[model samples]
Target chain A: MNMLEVTNLSISFGGLKAVNEFNLTIKKGQLYGLIGPNGAGKTTVFNLLTGVYKADTGTIVLDGQDLVKLSTIEINKAGIARTFQNIRLFKELTVIDNVKVGLHNGTPYSTFDGIFRLPKYFKAEKEITEKAMELLKVMGLEAEANFTAANLPYGKQRKLEIARALATSPKLLLLDEPAAGMNPNETAELMNTIRFVRDNFDMTILLIEHDMKLVSGICEEVTVLNFGTELTHGITADVLNDERVIKAYLGD
Target chain B: MKKLSKSTKNSLINYGMVIALYVVIMIIQLCGGLSNSMKGFLVPVCIYVIMAVSLNLVVGILGELSLGHAGFMCIGAYSGAIFSKLTEDTITVAPIRFTIAIIIGAVFAALFGALIGIPVLRLKGDYLAIVTLAFGEIIKNLVNVINFGVDSNGLHFSLKSAMDMGLAEDGKIIIKGAQGISGTPQDSNFTVGIILVLITLFVVQNLVNSRDGRAIMAIRDNRIAAESVGINITKYKLMVFTISAALAGAAGVLYSHNFSTLTSAGDKFNYNASIMILVYVVLGGIGNIRGSVIAAVILYILPEKLRFLSDYRMLVYAVVLIVVMLFNWSPKAKEFKEMVSYKIKGMFAKKEETQA
Candidate 1:
């Protein structure tokens, strides 16, 4: 029932190992968390998972498809979608259009269909608009669908990124610091949104976060990483309470 | 896009603007308000409009700088001119022949655009601009050294000269070295020019408002985010780049036919020519397709009309550029314009409500 199985994932920059021997497994529709301190290669692990950085040695299998050596775009097409640690919304595009860009692969019409404005173009576009709107409404952003993404409030921008990621309709969603700068209330809202997406969209999420409260609140399981290697991982409560994980996070 | 959609509204506005310009020109012609010189300027104006609009695709939407746009234009002009020159005897029908020539120009320019885009688009930077700048210079110089001819033995070409072509005694040089192509059937007219402008507008605007266009702009806005969302960066970038080049080719075909002789010398396919088109795109509000059309008309016509400004024509042109830049880009000016437009819309809404 595993949707994503990654083992022995490794990458290096020069002589330094950025992420080494990373192993992760997420069951279908499970919520997972990856927590690590600064310079501990959490984002690098996300990059490795998304094929942004080709793993030096590892096997990433999503729904029985081998993901290694695939390009970032191909990895996405293989059902792995990610959000950046820093919000990377298409800032100038409208909120709905950003989601539609994610829905680009699902667009049934060709460029020719679009250029000629054929009947199929109209039909396909209507479908795409409705679908993108559906995703925005799920993210509670229907009202600001026409607003440019950069103009959105910070909490809303984070939600927009999640909406865009869901537009890809991937089984496994990778969120890197989704609640990075949110206030406490926004973080609580995001936790609920994350759970809502996982339940309603049939999505399995693996997030990296520094916010311990958010991680423990929604994560079914947690993995602690330090200095390019796993510190420990288990049930969310146990991992958060582990002495070594705490020492790794805040040195004694 | 569906009817009354945001993009649909923008596209209708763009199409209406171009159609309105066409109507205005026709009216001036009917009233004999157009002087001979002004009449001569019509096709050139359309040509620049097409060029600016197409360039905006690359510079504005796709967010790539292309300095070699004129190189593609040169390729289009020469390829189109060569086809027309050789087919002068067989394709006696000017319309069919010119249509084929435009297609040839577009294809060749697209071929080169893809050729250059493959290497440059892979790397993220102003590499495209730098390489294209060099490409424009090289293509211009390259045309000068090319010699082309036709004879009983078929087509012959050489880099040296007409003598090096070694054609049959009955041969005629279609493209003599340094002289470029001559005797190309001048099938271009203002009506045709405007029609082609409309077609180019239709293609570029439609592309900008489509799924592919959204992907392209996403890549422009954030390459990493676009990649994560499954948009193929190279494919979309190259697609827009090729389309832009092809439209420039069509414009080049129109331009070459405007002249009795087609040559690479002067501002026709030089670096300055490419920069001039870029200026229109930038001053026109980058991704604003309709703005590009207006900028091309005003910037192109102003200097000619202001030739009456005597020695200060260029000075006046510089001032006009500053004003246009301010009007198009200054945030305060943008806010003011938006406020005015809102008021105008409100007035219309109130009138309709009262009538209701």
Candidate 2:
């Protein structure tokens, strides 16, 4: 069964159609890529799926539930988490603390428990910190866990964002431009880390990226969008070689 | 008990020190050359500390500049005052009556704050500031037009009859149009004030350091990202706003009984008072609890100390806020890094010391 299934999803800004009749499906444990040139409505689709923007039409189903009806937080509770195109870490919070925010849903402590330093609160906090640290370690960010997110190098910030998303225990992860500003070496490392997280965490990832090498190397499945319409989809090799995908990139 | 971090342990010690210091000051005030009238200033300072600290929760952590805080305080004060007056005959015990009044006041204020937060919190940044400011004004106007008084028949009467009834019978109780309410019970003692302050400080301190507080801060830092990661921004924002309002309401109860005579909440809880509390939070460092509390006390006391300045005191107050906010800008990059390094060093040192 598909982990995420979208059908006839559409949104419009006045006369401008941002995304229309967008549909796709991916099975569990799939690593998929969504790519297009600038202003291709790629991020717009991400926004709609995450409830940042309400879809003007259609349904999103995940794990046999109607996801379109859920609020963003509720959708996340149902095992969907995302990172932003522009790295949006909680800049002032410690790196580990940022990751811990992802674990807030799982934390059982109430306000009283935390304030009074109740035993349960401490136990939950300890468990959360340990789990956050483990995610950071897998992402090669264990050493920088105590540092503020804003102070990290750009590539590390991207990885930290992914680590934070992973901390949510998501079944399907959405990443927007996971390698926007990375150097070639940093991008290669990110490719490996993304693959490692996919296998280790047993996750299905849907990512948006402009880098063809990273997208082609890591994603087994790929979907292409152009002018808010799906141009092509299927295995990465077949979709990447589509004439429309190339023309959309070459602006022909 | 779970193992405590050094900072957590130090915070506990610091809280104990503050309570002790306040106790010493109270004793000195009672025993020293200061007269009873001079000691009255402590009541107002404690009141401001509660207001500043509670307001900090909304303004600092939630990252919403709320200008309607005094409205919530007004609601609390007036409701507390009215409740105490209504139940005075029923309950002879002073402290119990006072506690009931404060709780009612806080509940009412929290209800109103939550109601306002629902519609107003959707607006971002400056729009929210303006919306809250208007809400405060609307509350003040509503309080002015509101008619609340009971006659000897124990029947609720309008302002006009209440005044006429006052003059006809024993001229014991009187409240003229826009005039202050008089004949309130004087049961607010320093002990009660200190206890409530402790509760407020404790609750806010815990909230800021908890997962809920961290999520609120994350929402403040990056709304889109926070939402993407599954945080309900609206829920957390409204929760903090209501909690802050409830605390402000508690402060209102303490303020009401501390003063035997008071005017309609219109005069007492105004825009400037809320701004003053905001000034305290900003001057103290927004998210720093100790800083905001100390700032509140210092600012509240400064006016009294410089009473000789009289006409120039307001000017001085404005200048102080401006100077502090301007100079204590965001922490420098190097300093922040050093602070992090220090935390790490301290952590290792504690580990080694514990082992030894």
Best by DockQ: 1
What's the lDDT for all of these models?
0.90, 0.84
**Per-model TM values vs. the true structure:** 0.97, 0.90
DockQ scores of all models, one per candidate: 0.94, 0.69
Summed over model 1, clashes come to 0
Model 2 chain B: ten consecutive residues of lowest lDDT: B166-175
True contacts kept of 1: 0.97
lDDT computed for candidate 2:
0.84
Off by over 4 Å in 1: B1-3
